[model samples]
Structures are given as C-alpha cells and as structure tokens.
Target: MHSSKRKHIVVPLVLYCPLATFANTNPVAADDRLETVLVIGEQIKAALQAEQALTPGNVTVIDSADLYQRNIANLGDMLRYVPGIWTASGSTGDSTFFSSRGSNLDATNYDGNGIKLLQDGLPVTAADGNNHNRIMDPLGARYATIAQGANALTYGASTLGGAIDFTTPTARDTEPQIFLNDGSHGQLQGRVTTGLVAGAFDGLITIESKEWDGFRDHHQQERKGVYANAGWQFDDVVKTRFYFTYLDNDQELPGALTAEQFDENPYQAQPAAVIGHYQYNVETWRAANKTIFDINENSSLSVGFSYEDQTLYHPIVYSPFFSLLINTEQKNAGTSLRYNLHVNDHDLLAGINYGETTVDGGNYSHEAGRRKNMTTHVKNNADSLEIFLVDRWQIAPRWKLIYGVQAVSAGREVKNITVADGTLYNPGADYDSINPRAGVIYQFKSNNEAFANVSRLYEAPTNYELEDDSSPDNKALDAMHGSVIEIGARGKRPLGTHNKLHWEFSIYYAQLQDEILSIDNPTAPGTSLSTNVDDTIHAGIESLLGASFSLDANNNHRIEPLLSVTINEFSFDDDSHYGNNELPAAPGYALKGEILYRNSNGFFAGPTFDIIDERYADFSNTYTVDSYILLGLRTGFTHADWEVFGEVRNLTDKEYVSLFSVRDRAAPNAAILQAGEPRSVYVGMRLQF
Candidate 1:
C-alpha cells in the first residue's frame, strides 16, 4: 500500500509578497459579485465531494427520482437513455441483451469486453467472466451509476466496455412506498419499499412482481423478486451492511421473424419447430463493511470488504425440438483499501484490491431422456493497485486546468475442470497498463464552460475467450487495447423570467486494436474459433437539450422538456468474409424526446417518443430491418398520501420488431426479427407514508 499523504508550503519572500499584493490590488469586475463567488465555491465543493468518494473517471449517475419519473419497466428500458448503449429484446421479457459502443451482445465471451454488470459494487457475471443476458435482474434497482472503459479499473473485474453499479435501498430512514400499474398487452405490476431507522441501526426491504400476456402470440412472462438491506453504524468509524436478493421468472421466448413475416404479421408466432421457451431463477446474498479513519484534517483512509453468493438455473429452447439447460453457482469475495489526500490545489487517491471467485456448473444438451451432462468448475484470483492525481489549478481569472493520470497493475489466473473426461487446464495471465487522462475547462462569461479530454485504456481477455474449447490449437489470445478522444461543451442559461435551459454537445472517436472476433473455420464449418482481428473504429456524436418552465398564477403549472440524439458509425478494417460491413447490432441513429407537465392541483401529464433507425443483424449487412418509432402517453393525479397514474404505450398500434436474429440460417436467411410490444394501457396507484 502506498501512502498518499503529502505536505505543501509557500515560500515567504519580499518579491513574492509584492506579486501577491499586486494581484490583490487589481480591481474586481462588476459581474464578479460575492454571490457569484459563493455559487462557484459551492459547485467546486460538490465536485470535490464526488472526487473524494473514489468515483473519478467517466461516470454517470442516475438517481431514484429519475427512475420513478420515467416509469422504466426493465433493466434494458432503464438504460436506454445512456450514451453509447444499445439494447434489444428477442422475446417479451426472457430474451434481452445490452451492448455498449459498437460491441455485439452475443459476440464477446469476456464479461468485461463491452460491458460489466454489478450489484452493490459486486460483479454479477460468471466466474469465467461471462455475462448471461437472460439472468439480469433489475426489479430492485434504486440507483445506478455507469463508468466507461478502463476508467473502471478499481472494481477489479471484467470492465472492458465499462461497469454498471446498481444500488439498492438502504435502511437509514422511516418511509414506506407502494406502486401499481396495469397496461396494454395484459401487463400488470406492483412494487413496495419500506425502511426503518432507529439509533445506530437501519434496515430496508423491497418486493416487486410483474406479469404480462405479451404482444406477440405465445409470448408471455411472469416475474417476482425481493431485496432486503440492513446496516449497523458502529460509531463513526465502522459500518456494516447486509444485502439479499432473489428472483424467479418464467416466460415464453418468441424467436425472430423474417422481413416478410414482420411486415405481414409482426405479432404472429413462429412455427412450432422454431418456437422457444425459457425459465430463469436466481438467488444472491451479499455482505459488505466499511471502516474510515481520519488521520488529520486533510487526509483519510478507508477500507472495505465484500462477499457475494449467487445461484442460477436457466433453460432456453435452442430449436423447436431441443433445449439447453444450464445450472450455475458462483461465489465472489473481495477487499479494498483506499487513502485520500486533499491539498490546497490538488487531490490524490490510491487503492489496492484483491478478490477470488469460484464457479461450479454444468450444461444439459438434450431436451428429454438421459441428456448429455457436461460439468465445469473454474476459479479466478485477482490483485490490483491504482493511483490517481488531480489538480484544480487557477491558471487565470476565469480559467481552470483539470489534469489527472491513473496507473494500474493487475494479474489474474484461471483454473478450469472438465467433469466428464476428468481433464484439467490452468491458464495464468497477467498484464499491467498505465491509463493517462487529461482535461481542461475554461469558464467564460456567465455560466458557461468548454471542456475536452483524451484518454488511453486497455481491456483484458475474459475467461470464456481464453478457454472456449472450440479452438484446440489456439489457447492463448491477446488482450484488447483502445484509445478515445472526446470534446464536449455544456452550459446552463436562464431564458426570460420563468425558464431555464441546459444542454451539452459532444463528439468522440475510438480506435480498437486486437479486436476479438469469433469466426467459423473455413475448413471446419461447424466449429467456430475466437481470435484477435486487426482493428476497428467507432465514431459518434451525442447531444442533449433540456428545459424547464414555470407558468402563471392562474394555471400554476410547471413543464419540463428533454430531447436527445445519437449518431454512430462502426466498421471493421480487415479483409475477411465479412468485408467492411457494418457491425452487428449497431444502430445508426436514435432519437428520443419527452415533455412533462404538472399543475398545482397535483395533476401531471407527459408524452414521449422513442425512435431508432434501420440496423443490420449481421456484420455482412446482407439483410436490413426497417426503422420504427413509438409513442407513449402518461398522466396521473395525487391527493394527500395517495396517487393514481396511467400510461399507454404504442398508442397507434404500429407493429415492429424489437430484436433481430443473425445466427439462424434457415428460411430467414440473413435476419430474423422479433416483434415489438403492441399497444397496451396500464393504470396504477401508490400510497406513501
């Protein structure tokens, strides 16, 4: 462990004192009022608070208030607004996947290649660092934050694309909340959350249940989950928390449809030979403790330890006649220690982390009768250290330079076992990389700033990619490396007397080396192999505009509006079978806009639109899917402690595909489209006390 404590002092001299006196002697501008200084100081304090929490890097925070306001139904829906994220659903609720940047959901075998999912700071992926889309549970999400790429090194897991942390409710207050809703497609949902706080003890619990008949034929789903959290504050230096979550879900998985099928009857079911069914059940328990020690006024040290246990059973229909059943049990335990030092103009953060993982599972390859059972066991051990230094320097009267560098060293090892044949394999791999990041912000007149940043990041290979068994001769694969350049500007301004506007515009370019690709060997059609490709490039622009206004006394109304757009271009640079084709599952553009209104009488109404451009289902781009737009409306009223709300989705009853299938090579040929949800209406009420 490295100590981050340091001391700083200014030399006292006549010349230096004279310069300081001259600087103070300068007259202040009229716009530089005391209140302005106070506001700026407050903002700086807030930023420092975030930095001190070891939450540096490129991070986005989505609070609970925003979740309720959006009425998000699932994990995919909840993350739709995030930049550089792509989500698709094959069935109503059972088949869903999420990808970040230009990566495909089904392509990467590593858990951290394009994205990593976490609950309460613990990884949710398998021990081999593979993420199973069918087992993602989102019913208990209270707050979430996302960190992109190598910036997420502190988590000590697969974080190639980035890392997402979902925070559940904590028991530190006395409150109770309930929500209910019913909508189109025979959808119904209910949720409850309650918490209690007494002296140094606090606890919270949540329960959620949802059911839907689904939009397409034979597409139905049932879901139920519960989460509980308890914490004890043992004085001001030590705190411990316990968390538990469980979920049971059963659903019908509707396969994709052909282009003709999509146009003719988007809600029609696939043939019996192609219909698929899936069921998933999971239970997880976690415990974490935090201890903070203040050595002095400007320096502090904190230590944390966490452990998690999870078990899952997933069965999916591979074809109409066959199904694959997978049973998994995983355990992860880790500890982290961090020290923070705050100086007059600089802050330093350093931490060390260690973890171990154990996985025991097997796959059943047949639908009925003495099915072939393949059991596997694997273990991973990791150790890492990271350090960061940031300086908030006042270059001039209105300019500040923010610069930082993060250095990390990590090593991981995997041990795998094959049950049937009693074969064993041990692959030990280790790598170290230095990620340097720098940015500058110039404060102009009014409340405006211009900022730009460039960073270098590296991604390691996942366990699956290292030991897929598909390639017997090639057991070693290189890691993925990339760099990103970003430029953006954001500002807040007041419009007239009753409104305010805030907006941001950014453009980024990313280049990846040693990009992983899974291809079918030319001589061996049935066996697919994984290897690193030459290169790939992704470029995109993202923009957001938001405004809020207040109305006159008679109406006593408030209105808030937001709009966002993203344009992306993803391509490969290689001479392979695919040839300069568009990356699969990468949408060209996405647009979303919404308006919300509230009146003094406790009435609210809002309308929203979500649109996605045409996209390809495969790298070859041989097949194309038509683009679609969806319309939704929501309204509600509240009286005292009771509230009622309703929402209608797909109001026009337009049919479209929610997901596309690129793997099936039958009649669909190039692509198979899954129908989107049809028009549905839901009404619900909630009481808070």
Candidate 2:
C-alpha cells in the first residue's frame, strides 16, 4: 500500500520546568513523625512539580481554577489557549478533534494518533496507539499536563505528538457541587459530585449526563458517565489510591459533504448518512490502583496497575448498497513502576511500563445499521514493554545537564476468519527501538530559564491501518522515525504593584523518515488508503504571551490580555511524485487572542478571536480550502460557593470548512469537507457547599 497526507494550524515544542524541589527529598526529623496526616492533593502537586522540573522538553499545565468559568463543552474549549495545539469541534457528541506537532493531520475525527492520552498518570490510550475522543470528559479533571515530543518519555510514550495527562482530585480536595447547563440546539447537561472522609479513609464520586440535538440533521448525541475514587493513608511513608470509571456514549454521524453541497446548505446531512443511519455507540469500564512508598530517606517508589473493557457498535455506508457494520469488544491491561533517587544535586528517575490489548469483533454487511450477513471475524492483539532512565545533574549553580533513554519492544498480531471474501492475509509484526534524549538548561535569574534538547521519536502502525478489507494490496506498514531539536525560554516579571507579565517561546525542527500518511481515494467517495512517505520535514514556532494590569489607581478594576501563536512549515523533502511540496491538512499559521476586563466584584467579560490560514487538501496541491476567522464573546461571575457563565460563539455566523478528508489528488467539488458550526449561545451555572 502507498499513501499521501486537517487545516487549523498547529506547531512546535518547548521546555517548562517548575521551580520546585522534589517532594520528600529530605529526611523528616523523628520529632515530627508522630500523629502526622498526609494531604493527598498537596503531595500529588509537589511530586508532579518535582518530576516536571527534571524534564528537558516542552510541557504545559492547565489548571482548573479558571477553566470552569469558560464554556467548556468539549476538550477544545479547555485547550484553546494553549500554544502549539489545534482543536476543532465535531459538532456532535462531546467529540473534539485535536492535533499537536502536526500529528495525525490526515486521520479522521473518529480516530486519533501520535498523541498518548492518560488519566491520573495511567495509560488510557490502547497499546497500539488508538484513542477515542468522545470518552474523555474535560470537566472531570482538576488539572491537565501536556508533554510535547520527547517529554512524554516519562510516561513511556514515544509518539511525535507526545502525551496528555488529566489529574483528578481526591476527597481531601473536593467539595459537594452541582452543575447544570442549557445551550442552543436543544442541548442540556447536568452533573453532581460529592466527597467524604473518615479518619484515614476518603472517597469521592461524580455523575454526569448530557443530551444534545445537534445543529445538523441526523446528528443527535447522548452521554452519561460516573467517576469515583477512594484513598487510604496507612502512614506517612506509604499510601494507596483506587479509581473506577464508567461511560456510555452514543452519537449519529452526519458524514462529509461536497464543496457544492457545503455552499448550498452546510447543515444538511449527507444522503448516505440518512439512508444508512450512520451511528456510533460505545460503553466502557475502567479501574486502576496506585501506591507510593518511601523506600528510605533519599529514595521512593511508585507502582500502578490498570484494567479497561469496552464495547463498540458502529455502522457506516460506503455506497448505495455497500454498507458496513462493526461490533467489537476490546480489553486492555497495564502496569507501571517508577523509582526516584535524589543525591547531591542529582535527580535520577527510572521506570518500566508494560501493556497488553486484545480486540475481538466481526464485520458484517448491513442495511440501515442492521446486520444482514457476516463478512469477517477479527481477533487482534498488541503488547508493549518499555524501559526508561533519566538523570538530571547540576554541573554548576547556574547550569544543569539532562539525559535520558527509552527502550521499547512491541508486537502486533491479527487473526481473522473470512466468510465472503476469499483472501487470507493475516499478518503479524514486531518492533524494537531505543530512543535517546539529551538537553541542557541554564538559569539566568529567579523565575527565568532557558533550555534546549535533541531527541529521537518512533511510532508503529496501529491494527486499523493493517486490517483493511477493501484492498487486498494492504501490506504490513512500517514504523515511522524522526530526529528533532528544540530550544525555548520562559519567565515572568512583576511590572508593578498590581501588574505582571509572563511569556514562553520555543522553536522545533524534525527530520522524519518513513512518515505514515492516510489519504482519501480520489476515485471513491468515501474510501481511503494508507502508506508511508520516504521523507518529510516538520518545523514550527510556538509562543504564549500574557499580561495583567490595573485599570485604576485603586486597583479595583483590572484588564488582562493573552495571545498564543503557532507557525508551521511542514513539507515533503524532495519526494518522487511531489517534489518539495507542502503537506496537506495543516495550515501555515494560527493565532488566538483574548482581552478581558475584570471588576473587584468577581465579574469578567472577554472577547476572543481565532485565525487559521488557507491550506492544501491533497498531496499534489491541486485543491485547497480558504482561510477562516472566528469571533466569540464570554462573560462570567465567580464567587466562593457558586458561579455563573454565558458564551456566544461564531458570532459572525461564519461558514467555513472545519475539517476535511485528505487525498492524493482531488476534483473541484470533491465530497471531503466537514462544515463548521454556526452561531450559538450557551449558559451555565454551578453551586457548591
């Protein structure tokens, strides 16, 4: 098999090391060891700060304190202000299509790649690097950490886009709260959370539900979920926590529209979507446990175990009479062990991660989402073992040396039983790699630092790319590799008694080999092909700048302005068919900015804008989508026990392409574009005690 290469631009990587010492790095005195109680929230924060300080690569942390005041309907709403990341709403369900470092630019919104998604420092993405967007809830997290490029090696993720980890709060940091929201298109949602503590035991639980009648026809969605956790502290040096989660999500697919169709009526569903009743339904259950122990005064160990089971039912149509139905059951289990040692201005971290995933399912010929006949039975399995070591040495008072390496062994196997097709192309593959990282950091003054790093990245093909029934020519795909270098600086300065300024900037370049790409078959309306490119180049600049100042001498009124920009230059490096051509789907530049006015009475209002440049839609650079700009407004009021917020999006009712399918070549009016949402309004409120 061979292939070619989203639009909303995304880019780059940088360094963000917190200025905190490792938790428990110093021994506790004997007199202070009696009648001690551990605060879970503070401990976790301190530990994470300490861990991130040793990372020599880019990292961004999003706190929940200001997020709740925004209209957070999906992941995009929460991550919009983060530099080097691009997120687009799917308009149906709670789905969000996101990209980092130009990863998975051509993949469909239903599936994601390159990025590793995690929950509470545990792996949520499958062993083969597949993740579902609808199953994630942004409101459930206390904070989120985005580690770009080689920074993710700490979590055993070796992908180009890196890793995102969402941390949940325990009972000690939780309060009884209720939330409700009502928005345009018949949207309604509700959530309730509570926590309890008894002596050394504490527990927290949350339940949420949502229903939406989408802006497009045949695009209704529904979701419900429960998240719960319990913790126990036996002593000052040992503690453990248990977690459980369940989610049920169902959504209707509106399918893509041709350029002409989009111009006529962007909200109309595709004819195939209506006739085939395209839909996706999923149910999942997950459980995990983490324990920490202080081995001695200068060392600590952390162990984690996780299990997940999921069921999926999806039906789609390729043509008038060619419909497909997929029913599958997937199970995944994983374990992780991390040890930390601090000695004489040196910090050493070593870890091992093992994961196994199994998928059993069958594909069937379908009519209007109903199974008519079985076509193929599938049994796919994947497993991975990763070992990593990192050491941060302070060579001088103002400088440090950081180095790390990760070794991985992975395998993928597919066994299928065919019914109608007379082809037996069951394939299995094994991959092994040792990626290394090196960097240096220099401290100029308090609250200011500069860093640089070079690292190797690798990613193996997922099972979905290998088990294609539409084409017998689909052979086993090879893993992609890349070498990258990045440099960055970050700091904050006090402007005055009531004002401050902060900024972060970085640039990165990656020379990639055998870059995997998936593109639509130009001859077919809905079919796509996958292949590897011989050579490619990805480079970008990422920046975040913000400031706040008092509007009056009394400091009763304040104004805040923030800006984030990404510049990308992704292209083919003298390829055979497309010589020095720009890659499709990712824009050349993107900018997001906002200005807010805040009063002493806890009221705030802001205007936000986003701009995305024009981009190509095919590898040959024959077709393109025009640039687009969006405007929005947000207003909110916050208090100690409750909050209220309102939002208006797409204020100009702009009609533009939100996403599209990739292709090797395309016609003038190809059926590849997905329309963006129209104007809408939302209001929400929360109460806590």
Which number leads on lDDT? 2
Q: Against the hidden true structure, what lDDT does model 1 obtain?
A: 0.60
Residue-wise C-alpha lDDT for candidate 1, range 1-689, written one tens digit per residue: 01111110012122223432232232443234223334543454455335323332344555543455445567666776666666776465644566666654333421324665666655554333456432555546656766655445444432445677776555332135666656666566666666655567767666666776677776667666667778777766656676676666666555556677777887877653133334454555666665667767788777777777777665543544345565667677766676768776555555655555665676555442123565555554544444545455556766656555656555556566767677777665776676666656666655566666666656555555665434465355666677877666666798877789977666777888877655433332222356676778777776777898888746479898888777888877663655576666667998877888988898889997889998866556656667889999878887655678777777898787677554312234422567777787777776554
Residue 159 lDDT in candidate 1: 40
**What does the lDDT read for residue 545 in candidate 1?**
79
lDDT of 2 by residue, 383-478 (tens): 988899988999999898998999989888777778777565576789899999999888787767788999999988777665532335535778
Question: Roughly what TM-score does model 1 have, to 2 decimal places?
Answer: 0.81
After the best TM-score superposition of candidate 1, give how far the Cα of residue 37 lies from its true spot, in angstroms.
29
* TM values, all candidates: 0.81, 0.92
